[model samples]
Target: MLKYIMQLYKSKRLKVKHAFSSRQGGVSQPPYDSLNLAYHVGDRRDDVVKNHKLFAYEAGFDFKKLVFMNQIHSNKVHVVDEDSFLVPSCDALVTNLCDTPLMVMSADCAPVLFYDEVSKTVAAAHVGRKGAFGNIVKNVLDVMWERFGAEAENIVVAVGPNIKLCCYEVGEKEKSEAKNLGYGFALSGAHLDIDAIIAHQLQKEGVLKEHVEFLPHCTCCESERFFSYRAQGETGRNAAVIVLEDYV
Candidate 1:
Protein backbone atom coordinates (compact mmCIF):
# COMPACT_ATOMS: atom_id res chain seq x y z
CA MET A 1 0.00 0.00 0.00
CA LEU A 2 2.48 2.61 -1.12
CA LYS A 3 0.88 5.99 -1.63
CA TYR A 4 2.09 8.29 -4.41
CA ILE A 5 1.67 11.88 -5.47
CA MET A 6 0.79 11.97 -9.15
CA GLN A 7 1.98 14.60 -11.56
CA LEU A 8 -0.80 16.12 -13.67
CA TYR A 9 1.33 16.46 -16.82
CA LYS A 10 2.31 12.79 -16.61
CA SER A 11 -1.26 11.71 -15.87
CA LYS A 12 -2.64 13.62 -18.85
CA ARG A 13 0.04 12.26 -21.18
CA LEU A 14 -1.04 8.77 -22.30
CA LYS A 15 2.45 7.60 -23.22
CA VAL A 16 3.86 7.30 -19.74
CA LYS A 17 3.15 6.38 -16.12
CA HIS A 18 4.92 8.54 -13.53
CA ALA A 19 4.64 9.10 -9.78
CA PHE A 20 6.57 10.87 -7.02
CA SER A 21 6.40 8.76 -3.91
CA SER A 22 5.75 10.17 -0.46
CA ARG A 23 6.86 8.87 2.93
CA GLN A 24 3.64 7.04 3.58
CA GLY A 25 2.16 3.54 3.74
CA GLY A 26 5.54 1.77 4.23
CA VAL A 27 6.85 -0.81 6.69
CA SER A 28 10.26 0.69 7.60
CA GLN A 29 10.41 1.62 11.26
CA PRO A 30 11.33 4.89 13.02
CA PRO A 31 13.45 7.30 10.92
CA TYR A 32 12.92 5.52 7.62
CA ASP A 33 9.34 4.71 8.57
CA SER A 34 6.79 3.84 5.92
CA LEU A 35 7.57 3.76 2.16
CA ASN A 36 11.25 4.45 1.96
CA LEU A 37 12.24 3.40 -1.59
CA ALA A 38 16.04 3.78 -1.45
CA TYR A 39 18.54 1.03 -0.58
CA HIS A 40 21.61 3.15 0.16
CA VAL A 41 20.15 4.43 3.37
CA GLY A 42 20.12 2.54 6.66
CA ASP A 43 16.61 1.17 6.11
CA ARG A 44 16.34 -2.61 6.07
CA ARG A 45 16.84 -4.18 2.60
CA ASP A 46 13.73 -6.34 2.99
CA ASP A 47 11.63 -3.29 3.85
CA VAL A 48 13.07 -1.32 0.93
CA VAL A 49 12.42 -4.19 -1.50
CA LYS A 50 8.90 -4.67 -0.22
CA ASN A 51 8.27 -0.97 -0.45
CA HIS A 52 9.49 -0.97 -4.05
CA LYS A 53 7.20 -3.86 -4.92
CA LEU A 54 4.24 -2.15 -3.25
CA PHE A 55 4.95 1.10 -5.08
CA ALA A 56 5.44 -0.64 -8.41
CA TYR A 57 2.20 -2.58 -8.00
CA GLU A 58 0.31 0.55 -6.98
CA ALA A 59 1.78 2.49 -9.90
CA GLY A 60 0.78 -0.24 -12.39
CA PHE A 61 4.27 -1.44 -13.34
CA ASP A 62 6.27 -4.59 -12.71
CA PHE A 63 8.86 -4.15 -9.97
CA LYS A 64 11.34 -6.34 -11.85
CA LYS A 65 11.37 -3.93 -14.79
CA LEU A 66 12.21 -0.98 -12.60
CA VAL A 67 15.73 0.36 -13.04
CA PHE A 68 17.54 2.39 -10.38
CA MET A 69 20.64 4.58 -10.39
CA ASN A 70 23.48 4.68 -7.97
CA GLN A 71 23.17 8.44 -7.78
CA ILE A 72 26.47 10.23 -7.20
CA HIS A 73 25.27 13.79 -7.70
CA SER A 74 26.94 13.90 -11.10
CA ASN A 75 25.87 14.88 -14.62
CA LYS A 76 26.06 11.31 -15.93
CA VAL A 77 22.97 10.26 -17.86
CA HIS A 78 22.63 6.55 -18.60
CA VAL A 79 20.61 5.30 -21.56
CA VAL A 80 18.78 2.13 -20.60
CA ASP A 81 16.67 -0.68 -22.06
CA GLU A 82 15.40 -3.99 -20.70
CA ASP A 83 18.90 -5.46 -20.65
CA SER A 84 20.44 -2.31 -19.21
CA PHE A 85 19.06 -2.45 -15.69
CA LEU A 86 20.83 -1.43 -12.46
CA VAL A 87 23.11 1.37 -13.53
CA PRO A 88 26.00 2.34 -11.31
CA SER A 89 27.36 5.90 -10.72
CA CYS A 90 24.77 7.72 -12.76
CA ASP A 91 22.34 10.45 -11.78
CA ALA A 92 19.97 10.32 -14.74
CA LEU A 93 18.42 7.45 -16.72
CA VAL A 94 16.59 7.59 -20.05
CA THR A 95 14.64 4.87 -21.79
CA ASN A 96 12.25 4.40 -24.68
CA LEU A 97 11.58 0.77 -23.84
CA CYS A 98 8.00 0.02 -22.87
CA ASP A 99 7.14 -1.08 -19.33
CA THR A 100 10.64 -0.25 -18.12
CA PRO A 101 10.57 2.29 -15.33
CA LEU A 102 13.33 4.90 -14.89
CA MET A 103 13.58 5.87 -11.27
CA VAL A 104 15.72 8.37 -9.31
CA MET A 105 16.06 8.37 -5.56
CA SER A 106 16.44 11.60 -3.60
CA ALA A 107 16.00 12.97 -0.13
CA ASP A 108 16.67 16.71 -0.22
CA CYS A 109 18.04 16.61 -3.74
CA ALA A 110 15.65 17.32 -6.59
CA PRO A 111 14.18 14.43 -8.60
CA VAL A 112 13.29 15.46 -12.14
CA LEU A 113 11.26 13.23 -14.46
CA PHE A 114 10.94 13.68 -18.21
CA TYR A 115 8.41 12.33 -20.68
CA ASP A 116 8.79 12.93 -24.40
CA GLU A 117 5.44 12.28 -26.00
CA VAL A 118 6.80 12.53 -29.52
CA SER A 119 9.44 9.86 -28.97
CA LYS A 120 7.55 7.94 -26.31
CA THR A 121 10.60 8.12 -24.10
CA VAL A 122 10.93 8.75 -20.38
CA ALA A 123 13.84 9.81 -18.14
CA ALA A 124 14.48 10.48 -14.49
CA ALA A 125 17.30 12.61 -13.06
CA HIS A 126 18.63 12.96 -9.54
CA VAL A 127 19.51 16.65 -9.45
CA GLY A 128 21.28 18.12 -6.48
CA ARG A 129 23.42 21.24 -6.19
CA LYS A 130 26.39 19.64 -7.93
CA GLY A 131 24.30 18.10 -10.71
CA ALA A 132 22.37 21.31 -11.26
CA PHE A 133 25.58 23.33 -11.32
CA GLY A 134 26.81 20.88 -13.93
CA ASN A 135 23.66 21.39 -16.03
CA ILE A 136 22.41 17.81 -15.70
CA VAL A 137 19.02 18.79 -17.15
CA LYS A 138 20.67 19.85 -20.39
CA ASN A 139 22.64 16.63 -20.45
CA VAL A 140 19.47 14.59 -20.02
CA LEU A 141 17.64 16.52 -22.72
CA ASP A 142 20.58 16.08 -25.07
CA VAL A 143 20.54 12.33 -24.43
CA MET A 144 16.79 12.14 -25.01
CA TRP A 145 17.10 14.03 -28.27
CA GLU A 146 20.25 12.43 -29.68
CA ARG A 147 19.80 8.89 -28.42
CA PHE A 148 16.01 8.54 -28.42
CA GLY A 149 14.82 11.17 -30.93
CA ALA A 150 13.08 13.22 -28.27
CA GLU A 151 12.49 16.91 -28.80
CA ALA A 152 12.76 19.57 -26.15
CA GLU A 153 9.33 21.05 -26.87
CA ASN A 154 7.69 17.63 -26.94
CA ILE A 155 9.07 16.73 -23.52
CA VAL A 156 7.01 17.25 -20.38
CA VAL A 157 9.19 17.84 -17.32
CA ALA A 158 8.08 17.24 -13.76
CA VAL A 159 10.29 18.52 -10.92
CA GLY A 160 9.46 16.71 -7.69
CA PRO A 161 9.85 17.99 -4.12
CA ASN A 162 13.27 18.95 -2.78
CA ILE A 163 14.91 21.26 -0.30
CA LYS A 164 13.61 24.75 -1.06
CA LEU A 165 15.44 28.03 -0.50
CA CYS A 166 13.66 28.63 2.77
CA CYS A 167 15.41 25.60 4.22
CA TYR A 168 18.43 25.05 1.95
CA GLU A 169 21.37 26.87 3.44
CA VAL A 170 24.60 26.79 1.49
CA GLY A 171 28.20 27.49 2.29
CA GLU A 172 29.96 30.51 0.78
CA LYS A 173 31.82 28.18 -1.57
CA GLU A 174 28.56 26.73 -2.83
CA LYS A 175 27.09 30.19 -3.14
CA SER A 176 30.08 31.31 -5.18
CA GLU A 177 29.83 28.23 -7.38
CA ALA A 178 26.10 28.71 -7.92
CA LYS A 179 26.61 32.35 -8.67
CA ASN A 180 29.30 31.47 -11.16
CA LEU A 181 26.83 29.04 -12.70
CA GLY A 182 24.30 31.93 -12.97
CA TYR A 183 21.88 30.57 -10.35
CA GLY A 184 21.20 33.59 -8.17
CA PHE A 185 21.41 33.71 -4.40
CA ALA A 186 18.58 33.66 -1.87
CA LEU A 187 17.89 34.17 1.86
CA SER A 188 20.31 37.07 2.13
CA GLY A 189 23.15 34.98 0.72
CA ALA A 190 22.44 32.06 3.04
CA HIS A 191 20.19 29.90 0.82
CA LEU A 192 20.07 28.79 -2.79
CA ASP A 193 16.84 28.14 -4.71
CA ILE A 194 17.92 24.92 -6.39
CA ASP A 195 14.37 24.32 -7.59
CA ALA A 196 14.26 27.63 -9.39
CA ILE A 197 17.68 26.96 -10.83
CA ILE A 198 16.44 23.64 -12.22
CA ALA A 199 13.34 25.27 -13.70
CA HIS A 200 15.43 27.97 -15.29
CA GLN A 201 17.72 25.34 -16.75
CA LEU A 202 14.69 23.55 -18.22
CA GLN A 203 13.47 26.75 -19.84
CA LYS A 204 16.96 27.57 -21.06
CA GLU A 205 17.07 24.15 -22.72
CA GLY A 206 13.96 25.19 -24.71
CA VAL A 207 11.41 23.28 -22.66
CA LEU A 208 8.17 25.23 -22.69
CA LYS A 209 7.13 26.71 -19.38
CA GLU A 210 3.65 25.29 -19.80
CA HIS A 211 5.14 21.81 -20.15
CA VAL A 212 7.27 22.07 -17.02
CA GLU A 213 5.50 21.31 -13.74
CA PHE A 214 7.01 21.89 -10.32
CA LEU A 215 5.90 20.22 -7.10
CA PRO A 216 6.75 23.17 -4.81
CA HIS A 217 6.46 21.23 -1.57
CA CYS A 218 9.86 21.44 0.12
CA THR A 219 11.20 18.19 1.52
CA CYS A 220 12.84 19.90 4.48
CA CYS A 221 9.67 21.80 5.36
CA GLU A 222 7.42 18.80 4.84
CA SER A 223 9.58 16.28 6.63
CA GLU A 224 6.60 14.26 7.83
CA ARG A 225 5.42 13.53 4.30
CA PHE A 226 8.81 13.39 2.52
CA PHE A 227 12.33 12.44 3.50
CA SER A 228 14.79 15.33 3.83
CA TYR A 229 18.51 14.77 4.20
CA ARG A 230 18.95 18.31 5.46
CA ALA A 231 16.21 17.91 8.04
CA GLN A 232 17.38 14.49 9.16
CA GLY A 233 21.13 14.04 8.76
CA GLU A 234 20.89 10.34 7.94
CA THR A 235 17.52 9.47 6.40
CA GLY A 236 15.76 7.49 3.72
CA ARG A 237 14.98 8.81 0.25
CA ASN A 238 11.85 9.43 -1.82
CA ALA A 239 11.60 8.17 -5.40
CA ALA A 240 10.54 9.75 -8.67
CA VAL A 241 9.68 7.10 -11.26
CA ILE A 242 8.43 7.07 -14.86
CA VAL A 243 7.71 4.26 -17.30
CA LEU A 244 6.59 4.05 -20.93
CA GLU A 245 3.28 2.16 -21.18
CA ASP A 246 3.37 -1.18 -22.97
CA TYR A 247 1.11 -1.17 -26.00
CA VAL A 248 -0.08 -4.43 -27.52
Candidate 2:
Protein backbone atom coordinates (compact mmCIF):
# COMPACT_ATOMS: atom_id res chain seq x y z
CA MET A 1 0.00 0.00 0.00
CA LEU A 2 2.94 2.33 -0.42
CA LYS A 3 2.35 5.33 -2.71
CA TYR A 4 5.01 6.79 -5.00
CA ILE A 5 5.30 9.57 -7.52
CA MET A 6 5.89 7.58 -10.69
CA GLN A 7 7.08 8.89 -14.04
CA LEU A 8 7.40 6.53 -16.97
CA TYR A 9 9.43 7.88 -19.88
CA LYS A 10 8.16 5.96 -22.87
CA SER A 11 8.85 6.24 -26.54
CA LYS A 12 8.88 3.89 -29.49
CA ARG A 13 12.54 3.28 -28.85
CA LEU A 14 12.77 2.75 -25.06
CA LYS A 15 11.09 2.98 -21.70
CA VAL A 16 12.53 3.69 -18.22
CA LYS A 17 11.03 3.28 -14.77
CA HIS A 18 11.45 6.28 -12.47
CA ALA A 19 9.97 7.01 -9.04
CA PHE A 20 10.19 9.71 -6.34
CA SER A 21 9.21 8.60 -2.86
CA SER A 22 7.20 10.71 -0.49
CA ARG A 23 7.29 10.68 3.33
CA GLN A 24 4.06 8.75 3.54
CA GLY A 25 3.38 4.93 3.60
CA GLY A 26 6.07 3.31 5.72
CA VAL A 27 7.02 2.60 9.35
CA SER A 28 9.25 4.97 11.29
CA GLN A 29 8.52 7.68 13.85
CA PRO A 30 7.76 11.38 14.02
CA PRO A 31 10.21 13.45 11.96
CA TYR A 32 11.37 10.28 10.20
CA ASP A 33 7.79 9.03 10.32
CA SER A 34 7.00 6.46 7.61
CA LEU A 35 8.74 5.69 4.32
CA ASN A 36 12.09 7.16 5.24
CA LEU A 37 14.47 5.73 2.67
CA ALA A 38 17.80 6.87 4.12
CA TYR A 39 19.70 5.22 6.98
CA HIS A 40 22.34 7.84 7.79
CA VAL A 41 19.82 10.37 9.01
CA GLY A 42 19.49 8.74 12.46
CA ASP A 43 16.53 6.56 11.40
CA ARG A 44 16.64 3.03 12.80
CA ARG A 45 18.34 0.50 10.53
CA ASP A 46 15.46 -1.98 10.79
CA ASP A 47 12.90 0.67 9.87
CA VAL A 48 14.98 1.83 6.93
CA VAL A 49 15.36 -1.71 5.63
CA LYS A 50 11.65 -2.38 5.94
CA ASN A 51 10.88 0.89 4.24
CA HIS A 52 13.17 -0.02 1.36
CA LYS A 53 11.45 -3.36 1.07
CA LEU A 54 8.07 -1.67 0.88
CA PHE A 55 9.36 0.82 -1.65
CA ALA A 56 10.93 -1.88 -3.73
CA TYR A 57 7.75 -3.93 -3.69
CA GLU A 58 5.65 -0.97 -4.73
CA ALA A 59 8.13 0.30 -7.33
CA GLY A 60 8.60 -3.15 -8.88
CA PHE A 61 12.34 -3.44 -8.23
CA ASP A 62 14.48 -5.62 -6.00
CA PHE A 63 15.69 -3.91 -2.83
CA LYS A 64 18.88 -5.95 -2.94
CA LYS A 65 19.76 -4.63 -6.42
CA LEU A 66 19.55 -1.00 -5.43
CA VAL A 67 22.74 1.10 -5.20
CA PHE A 68 22.93 4.22 -3.09
CA MET A 69 25.52 6.96 -2.78
CA ASN A 70 27.13 8.53 0.23
CA GLN A 71 26.25 11.94 -1.10
CA ILE A 72 28.93 14.49 -0.21
CA HIS A 73 27.43 17.40 -2.07
CA SER A 74 30.15 17.20 -4.68
CA ASN A 75 29.94 16.98 -8.51
CA LYS A 76 31.31 13.41 -8.58
CA VAL A 77 29.52 11.00 -10.90
CA HIS A 78 29.94 7.25 -10.57
CA VAL A 79 29.57 5.15 -13.72
CA VAL A 80 28.29 1.82 -12.41
CA ASP A 81 27.06 -1.56 -13.66
CA GLU A 82 25.54 -4.71 -12.25
CA ASP A 83 28.86 -5.64 -10.67
CA SER A 84 29.24 -2.24 -9.09
CA PHE A 85 27.21 -3.07 -6.04
CA LEU A 86 29.35 -1.31 -3.42
CA VAL A 87 28.14 2.15 -2.46
CA PRO A 88 30.46 4.92 -3.59
CA SER A 89 31.06 8.47 -2.48
CA CYS A 90 29.45 10.57 -5.19
CA ASP A 91 26.56 12.88 -5.87
CA ALA A 92 25.39 11.19 -9.05
CA LEU A 93 25.15 7.60 -10.32
CA VAL A 94 24.76 6.36 -13.91
CA THR A 95 24.18 2.84 -15.14
CA ASN A 96 22.92 0.95 -18.17
CA LEU A 97 22.37 -2.33 -16.33
CA CYS A 98 18.81 -3.58 -16.25
CA ASP A 99 16.85 -3.97 -12.97
CA THR A 100 19.66 -2.41 -10.95
CA PRO A 101 18.25 0.74 -9.41
CA LEU A 102 20.32 3.90 -8.97
CA MET A 103 19.00 5.91 -6.07
CA VAL A 104 19.69 9.39 -4.68
CA MET A 105 18.59 10.44 -1.22
CA SER A 106 17.58 14.03 -0.56
CA ALA A 107 15.56 16.10 1.85
CA ASP A 108 15.39 19.69 0.63
CA CYS A 109 18.02 19.26 -2.03
CA ALA A 110 16.87 18.22 -5.47
CA PRO A 111 16.86 14.59 -6.60
CA VAL A 112 17.25 14.50 -10.38
CA LEU A 113 16.73 11.41 -12.52
CA PHE A 114 18.04 10.98 -16.05
CA TYR A 115 17.27 8.44 -18.77
CA ASP A 116 18.56 8.23 -22.32
CA GLU A 117 16.16 6.39 -24.56
CA VAL A 118 18.72 5.81 -27.28
CA SER A 119 21.31 4.23 -25.04
CA LYS A 120 18.88 2.70 -22.56
CA THR A 121 20.79 4.19 -19.64
CA VAL A 122 19.57 5.66 -16.37
CA ALA A 123 21.04 8.07 -13.77
CA ALA A 124 20.21 9.55 -10.39
CA ALA A 125 21.77 12.71 -8.95
CA HIS A 126 21.71 14.47 -5.59
CA VAL A 127 21.72 18.12 -6.53
CA GLY A 128 21.93 20.31 -3.46
CA ARG A 129 23.11 23.92 -3.57
CA LYS A 130 26.73 22.85 -3.34
CA GLY A 131 26.32 20.03 -5.84
CA ALA A 132 24.57 22.30 -8.33
CA PHE A 133 27.24 24.96 -7.89
CA GLY A 134 29.80 22.22 -8.50
CA ASN A 135 28.02 21.47 -11.82
CA ILE A 136 26.87 17.96 -10.92
CA VAL A 137 24.18 17.98 -13.60
CA LYS A 138 26.64 18.63 -16.39
CA ASN A 139 29.05 16.07 -14.96
CA VAL A 140 26.31 13.42 -15.01
CA LEU A 141 25.52 14.20 -18.63
CA ASP A 142 29.19 14.00 -19.51
CA VAL A 143 29.51 10.58 -17.89
CA MET A 144 26.39 9.38 -19.65
CA TRP A 145 27.66 10.50 -23.04
CA GLU A 146 31.25 9.36 -22.67
CA ARG A 147 30.70 6.09 -20.83
CA PHE A 148 27.28 4.89 -22.00
CA GLY A 149 27.10 6.38 -25.51
CA ALA A 150 24.13 8.46 -24.46
CA GLU A 151 23.18 11.44 -26.58
CA ALA A 152 22.15 14.69 -24.96
CA GLU A 153 19.16 15.08 -27.24
CA ASN A 154 17.96 11.57 -26.40
CA ILE A 155 18.11 12.12 -22.64
CA VAL A 156 14.95 12.73 -20.63
CA VAL A 157 15.35 14.27 -17.17
CA ALA A 158 13.01 14.30 -14.18
CA VAL A 159 13.68 16.89 -11.44
CA GLY A 160 12.00 15.74 -8.25
CA PRO A 161 10.70 17.81 -5.32
CA ASN A 162 12.94 20.13 -3.29
CA ILE A 163 12.87 23.42 -1.48
CA LYS A 164 11.59 25.84 -4.09
CA LEU A 165 12.04 29.61 -4.04
CA CYS A 166 8.69 30.02 -2.32
CA CYS A 167 10.20 28.88 1.00
CA TYR A 168 13.95 28.54 0.37
CA GLU A 169 15.51 31.67 1.80
CA VAL A 170 19.24 32.19 1.66
CA GLY A 171 21.77 34.71 2.89
CA GLU A 172 23.83 37.10 0.78
CA LYS A 173 26.95 34.94 0.75
CA GLU A 174 25.20 31.97 -0.78
CA LYS A 175 23.26 34.15 -3.19
CA SER A 176 26.43 35.94 -4.24
CA GLU A 177 28.20 32.63 -4.74
CA ALA A 178 25.39 31.30 -6.94
CA LYS A 179 25.41 34.51 -8.90
CA ASN A 180 29.14 34.17 -9.34
CA LEU A 181 28.50 30.72 -10.75
CA GLY A 182 26.47 32.47 -13.49
CA TYR A 183 23.11 31.42 -12.00
CA GLY A 184 20.58 34.09 -11.12
CA PHE A 185 19.11 34.38 -7.63
CA ALA A 186 15.55 35.24 -6.71
CA LEU A 187 13.39 36.87 -3.97
CA SER A 188 15.54 39.97 -4.35
CA GLY A 189 18.66 38.00 -3.45
CA ALA A 190 17.06 36.05 -0.61
CA HIS A 191 15.86 32.85 -2.27
CA LEU A 192 17.44 30.48 -4.78
CA ASP A 193 15.39 28.69 -7.41
CA ILE A 194 17.42 25.48 -7.55
CA ASP A 195 15.09 23.71 -9.99
CA ALA A 196 15.42 26.55 -12.49
CA ILE A 197 19.17 26.48 -12.11
CA ILE A 198 19.26 22.72 -12.82
CA ALA A 199 16.91 23.11 -15.78
CA HIS A 200 19.15 25.77 -17.22
CA GLN A 201 22.12 23.48 -16.74
CA LEU A 202 20.35 20.63 -18.55
CA GLN A 203 19.46 22.94 -21.44
CA LYS A 204 23.02 24.19 -21.57
CA GLU A 205 24.09 20.56 -21.87
CA GLY A 206 21.71 20.27 -24.90
CA VAL A 207 18.89 18.33 -23.21
CA LEU A 208 15.57 19.15 -24.86
CA LYS A 209 13.09 21.27 -22.94
CA GLU A 210 10.15 19.06 -23.85
CA HIS A 211 11.96 15.99 -22.56
CA VAL A 212 12.73 17.48 -19.12
CA GLU A 213 10.00 17.03 -16.51
CA PHE A 214 9.97 18.97 -13.23
CA LEU A 215 7.87 17.77 -10.32
CA PRO A 216 6.40 21.03 -9.05
CA HIS A 217 6.01 20.09 -5.38
CA CYS A 218 8.22 21.87 -2.85
CA THR A 219 9.47 19.55 -0.10
CA CYS A 220 9.73 22.26 2.51
CA CYS A 221 6.31 23.64 1.71
CA GLU A 222 4.71 20.21 1.59
CA SER A 223 6.04 18.75 4.84
CA GLU A 224 2.93 16.58 5.16
CA ARG A 225 4.13 14.41 2.26
CA PHE A 226 7.89 15.02 1.89
CA PHE A 227 10.65 15.16 4.53
CA SER A 228 12.44 18.50 4.40
CA TYR A 229 15.73 18.87 6.24
CA ARG A 230 15.65 22.60 5.85
CA ALA A 231 12.33 22.77 7.62
CA GLN A 232 12.69 19.98 10.16
CA GLY A 233 16.42 20.39 10.99
CA GLU A 234 16.99 16.69 11.71
CA THR A 235 14.89 14.92 9.12
CA GLY A 236 14.78 11.71 7.16
CA ARG A 237 15.60 11.59 3.46
CA ASN A 238 13.31 10.96 0.50
CA ALA A 239 14.57 9.20 -2.58
CA ALA A 240 14.57 9.42 -6.36
CA VAL A 241 15.16 6.09 -8.05
CA ILE A 242 15.54 4.83 -11.62
CA VAL A 243 16.06 1.41 -13.20
CA LEU A 244 16.28 0.10 -16.75
CA GLU A 245 13.79 -2.72 -17.18
CA ASP A 246 14.77 -5.80 -19.14
CA TYR A 247 13.83 -5.33 -22.78
CA VAL A 248 11.07 -7.71 -23.80
Clashing pairs in 2: none
lDDT of 1 by residue, 203-222 (tens): 88899988887787899999
Q: 1-248, model 2: which lDDT tens digit per residue?
A: 44544322223222477688888778888778878899898989999999898888887898998899999999999988656778679899998888888889999999988998788889999999998888899999999999989999999888888899898888988988887888874335587888888888899999998888878789999987888987889889888888989987
Query: Each model's TM-score, in the order given?
Result: 0.92, 0.92
Models, CA RMSD each: 2.9, 3.2
Q: Name model 2 segments beyond 4 Å from true.
A: 1-15, 185-187
TM-score of 2: 0.92
* Steric collisions counted per model: 2, 0
lDDT at residue 1 of model 2 (Cα atoms): 42
lDDT of each: 0.83, 0.85
Supply the global lDDT for candidate 2. 0.85
Best by lDDT: 2
